[model samples]
Target: MDVIGGKWKALILWELENYGVRRFGELRRGLPGVSEKMLIQQLRELEEDGIVTREVYREVPPRVEYQLTELGTALNRALEPLGDWGRDRIERIGANRVHPVTT
Candidate 1:
């Protein structure tokens, strides 16, 4: 739970899995609600956990992109069923949105 815990981690993995390699700005743009600091921290932790790879290129402006490692790919695949379950629950909850009167 620790490795892929929190609001941002799973979303981050989803973006990389769907989009392939992405730069810092691309990640920020993809995840609209995430702040810069939170994104940086999440990426660092993911990298440290060997879930993502960060590559830097030398240039006038430094370029860095992140992609999932092999282990990360496997983990993401494992989570696909969880995603489907969550989506089903979301639909069910939405259908049952009417609340009962409380005493």
Candidate 2:
């Protein structure tokens, strides 16, 4: 759970899954709220965990892209049902009440 647990990791994975391959700038743009430092940290962790692959291109400006590994693909697939359930629960509770007050 730790490998993919967090606010941004799963979202990052989902984005990669949807887009196939994404560059650093692309991911940064896609996730508007995530800071560059946090994104880099998360990507590094994911790469170290073998859930993501990073490729670099040799060029003047340089280019780097990220993709999900086999393990990452399986993990994302396994979480599909969980994602669906969350969506349903959110709808049932209403988006504005997703985090209701607790006293």
Candidate 3:
């Protein structure tokens, strides 16, 4: 739970799952609220946890991309039920009535 537990990490994983391979700029754009430094930190943690893979390419501008590992896919599958339950709860109780749970 600690691995994927964070305000932005799960969102980052969702973005990666939605988009196959994403560059730093792409991820930054996708998650406008996240600071670049925080994104970098979260991505490094994810990579270290074996949930994400970072690829670097030798190019004029130096390109780097992030993709989900097999473990990440499994993690996402595990999270789907929770996500559904949250959505259902929100639909049933309404967003204002649903209290956000913190770690």
Candidate 4:
């Protein structure tokens, strides 16, 4: 869970799940405001955790792409409920100016 316990990880996973496989540059472009260094670190961590697969093409410029593994896909599915809950909460908060109390 630690691997996915960051602000960017879930967003990254969601983008990957929706977009299928993506190149490093493409992922970076998809996620605005994410630094290149942070993206690299997160991708490395995900790859090391066996949740994301990184493929390197033996080309002149060395193309690379990242995709989620089966485990990662399952994890995303598990997080769907939480994601929906968050979306609903956001919508409710938008509808009602009353701020939600934080514990």
| Decoy 1 TM-score against native | 0.91
Worst 10 residues of 3 by lDDT: 94-103
Q: Write the per-residue lDDT of candidate 1 for residues 1-103, one digit (tens) a residue.
A: 9999999999999999999999999999999999999999999999999999999999769999999999899999999999999999888777777653356
List ranges where model 3 is wrong by over 4 Å: 95-103
* lDDT of each residue in 15-77, candidate 2, tens digit only: 999998999999999888999999999999999999999999998799999999999999999
lDDT measured at residue 64 in model 4 versus the true structure, 0 to 100: 100
Candidate 3, overall lDDT?
A: 0.92
How far in Å is the alpha carbon of 20 misplaced in model 3? 0.7
Clashing pairs in 2: none
Candidate 1 ranges with C-alpha deviation above 4 Å? 98-103
How many pairs of residues collide in each model?
A: 0, 0, 0, 0
RMSD of each: 2.4, 3.5, 5.0, 3.1
Question: Of the candidates shown, which would achieve the greatest lDDT relative to the real structure?
Answer: 1
Off by over 4 Å in 4: 98-103
TM-score for each predicted model, relative to the true structure: 0.91, 0.88, 0.87, 0.91
> Who is ahead in lDDT, 1 or 4?
1
